[model samples]
Target: MVRIDDLQVFIRAADNGSLSAAARQLDLSPAVASAALKRLEAAVGAQLLARSTRSLRLTVAGERYLEHARAALDALQSGSVALAQDRQALSGSLSLSMPSDLGRNLLRPWLDAFLQQHPGLSLQLQISDRVADLYRQPVDVALRYGVPEDSALVALPLAPDNRRVLCASPDYLARHGAPAAPQDLRRHSCLRFILGAAVHERWSFLRNGERQVVTVDGRWHSDDGEIVRNWALAGLGIAYKSRLDVLADLRAGRLQPLLEGYDTEQTPLYLVTPHRLMLSPAAVALRAHLQQCLDAYLAGPRAGEGRNDSCD
Candidate 1:
């Protein structure tokens, strides 16, 4: 049987377009990536990739083989999840990645409770504003907002990732005046989340059933959502934020919504893991616990309102 690690290298190299990029994603050296690909090809007795000075191209056989290998890895992961489901006690390390804002404000309490329940389970959670690779890093699961591009991973939708109201603090809104239309934002100070892929970095809105993309100019830009939130709360500028992030402030009249008739671009939230047949007990436990926490949180009184984090 071909080693799973070799197949993983093969898949990463194919997906990422270069051995070097794949190596970086996988935390391996370029030579290690190349060697693994060679080993995989040899074990399969087929030339999988055509390599040149500047580019890597997949052979027809490589395409078919990649599909099969990915399926096999997915089956393995699914099986692990199933095995974990049968166990009464979870005992393993589970690594998770999540956007820093959501992890800190929304899921912190639930995570604490979960850790208490599974004393043997160790967690390594990396809170990031950018998306991390599930196959590349040691993360077992990830909390992703928006639709996933990769078909290989299994994404379980946990909540309605709906449009949120964008606004500034009352003092800022009073000074800057609320945007009468989406176009009016061009004259206002906008705070932006400058991290993540370019796809998610831009602000989008809809008005009169027409969609608009605004390349916003901000006086302050940061990768950290908390910092952006603070800037908005300080009445520095307008921030386009999720209701989950700004709900409490809205209720308290700290921030006032602008362009009330326009739609705020929304992204769905999911608990994603490698699609496989077997998942470790710890990962399974965390996934379920996260879902429950999310459900309870969304249903609770604080669901749509923002919580105060002025210290942010």
Candidate 2:
């Protein structure tokens, strides 16, 4: 095998015109450096140098191989430098798998602004309700609500305090009086969402440190989260949705949060990667940008008294 150190010695010896000089430059004994040149020549089946007691210079074969060796070394060094830089600079492609409702309605604009700031950065977005298979899919990171079932995944909190808010459009509320409590939801039309195989029929809430679990029924149900939000917007029924997904609507007063005093369910948002080492610079920067956007959004005035309305 052709050792890289051998090639380095040959190149340096040829450039310096002295085996001893090259050995000193490389911090290797003269005998070791000379042996490296011989091993390299034997491996390549060519005499790479013609050395005398007074002088040392490249032979015909050495002249032919020197340029190629230098180029190979340069390529390897540059590759290492680029890889190290990639760990620090947000200048690469970032693939994100996110829920349809939040990805399209809420995060789209924020992510757009983020891309504008990083000209070299690009995005590949997979917007879906089904959980992304991190091992099977080409996803770099997943922006999802709720804890990851895979304990091995590195979940970076995007919105740890986010919740699942129960809300309905004003038109729906006017037609059928809003439910004042979690148990009251049984009397009104609810907009249910099917996550995977499970139907979200049971809703839970906490108020005054007491728990309330309601088995709610609705006329409408959809696998698509955005569709449920749309149905809620069209006054079809009350919807239980991720807070971030409905933040814009809540602010615009298009959807009114029901059960004011009662704290609804939690749906904390996370940026998930296969492992901590898999987290790239671009993903880290994107996480920061999304978090800042959420914080700023929550701080903004509510359409009404501008409730603190922290990003769920």
Candidate 3:
């Protein structure tokens, strides 16, 4: 008979691509995890994994069984959740990935309030500007800007009205003078954020019903979005950033919006998961809660009508 625990271990190992990493996530010792995999293989009557000293690969049989195994686990979890008398008493570990600026400035307070409401829950937050792999990494969900590139993931929009805007400090504008047109950016210093190998110096905007792409250059660049925002705040250069990341600064008069006549392109904010069925109850609740929070924030007085942050 194939034990359910053994199947779970097998599935986790496959998802992580390493037995030791999966073992740590599941809180199982290396020996026990290895034994569980062997038991699962014995019950299935196939060598489910091809293992070398450095890596592990799923065999054809393992590949065939993976989807079914995931479904089985999901069904079990669903049944368990259905039996709970208090649906609001959510208890589980949730691992999340998000960008540095948003995580530190905006979502931190929201997440703290969320955890307070459900004291049974624990959170593991991975804060970085780099994109995380939901399929291969230990992250359960990721809050990301822009459309997802991977078709295998499910993207739940948290803020559809979120957009990027070009901004600079008043001091910087006083010193360099604000650009009246996209082409005018060539004469100004711009701070850029790097995503992987690509520098995000190309900015897109719409003017007079026409799209314009401007290749910008700056005196400094960084991999972290927060660093770029900081540079813009310090009166170093102009920066194109998500409105959500700079809304407080913009409202506080620390940063001034530039090129109000032109419309900057909008990118969506999403809560992405590797598999819909694999999402835990905690993840589901959190997604809904975040959506509500964002909606309320957008509707609040601070988010005044016809504001650029409204993405209208």
C-alpha TM-score for every candidate: 0.76, 0.69, 0.75
The TM-score obtained by model 1 is 0.76
**Superposed model 1: Cα runs more than 4 Å off:** 1-57, 133-136, 149-154, 196-202, 273-279, 300-312
Q: Rank candidates, lDDT, best first.
A: 3, 2, 1
Regions of candidate 2 where Cα sits further than 4 Å from its true position = 1-89, 302-312
| Model 2 Cα lDDT, one tens digit per residue, 24-71 | 867899999989999999999999899899999888999999878877
Per-candidate Cα lDDT values, in order, are 0.77, 0.84, 0.85
Q: For each candidate, how many residue pairs have backbone atoms clashing (under 3 Å)?
A: 20, 2, 0
Q: How well does candidate 2 match the true structure in TM-score terms?
A: 0.69
Query: Which residue pairs collide, candidate 2?
Result: 162-312, 302-306
Candidate 2 global lDDT = 0.84
Worst 10 residues of 3 by lDDT: 303-312
Query: Which 10-residue span in candidate 1 carries the lowest summed lDDT?
Result: 303-312
